[model samples]
Target: MTNATAERPLHSVSVAGIVVREDGRVLVIQRADNGAWEPPGGILERNERPEEGVRREVAEETGVTVEVERLTGVYKNLTLGVIALVFRCRPVGGEERLSDESTDVRWLTPEEVEQSMKEVFSVRVADALDAAAPHVRSHDGERLIAAA
Candidate 1:
């Protein structure tokens, strides 16, 4: 492999958790650096499994423990070469608190998410909320494109 190719992989795998409380509120976080509200997630570690990564990311960002239920959707940011596996999760324990990665954490209703987030990020929550079938989608980081 070329040095440049070795330095960066073709794409990166990330995991996101769509956590919902019994009250039907969804978890959302405002990023510390960007201040954009979205689900809790991050890059999967080298040796971590995707499900474990999802759990860890949610706990780290929102300070809530979760039980991952099932795969909800898969999203790709085509512009950034990021593939994110989103899972449906149920809150198990822990009180909400802000981490270094998050500036704010809130439990929002479905209507609130639609009003608060951009379409691309909001779809992730919508897919989970539907809880019907796994959605596979691609985006240019802001707008979603029809799946290929």
Candidate 2:
């Protein structure tokens, strides 16, 4: 058997966008499979750039066109080896519509998100809303943990 050190490690890179509207509302989606409401995002494709992947994922999941403003956070799912880059964006065009990935989409205020979403997910949106500095956080897919 190959030694662990010799085996190549695998990790998936993902991107998420927080699309804020003019009226101080953020766009979120209820995933079809799990009903969890979070920002629109997905794993980056092998041939795609980070910005392009984020834009495509948002459009596919929420049917909204966004102009990426700036990166707002970085998160890692430690158990899954998934690294996520979160960005702040503005809705440039398109309307909210259901897609294969998302079952529901809606605009929510910061208070609504804090009450509805889990801490890990809420932190992503919160970071975007604050727009102070980029947050780097780690999680076990559900709960955020203190970085080691």
lDDT of 1 by residue, 25-88 (tens): 9999999999999999999998999999999999999999999999999999999999999999
Q: Model 1 shows how many backbone clashes?
A: 0
TM-score, cand. 1 vs. native: 0.93
lDDT of 2 by residue, 20-77 (tens): 9999999999999999999999999999988898899999998899999999999999
Candidates' C-alpha lDDT: 0.94, 0.92
Candidate 2 residue-wise lDDT at 19: 93
Candidate 1 lDDT:
0.94
TM-score of 2: 0.93
Q: List TM-scores for all candidates, in order.
A: 0.93, 0.93
Top model number, lDDT: 1
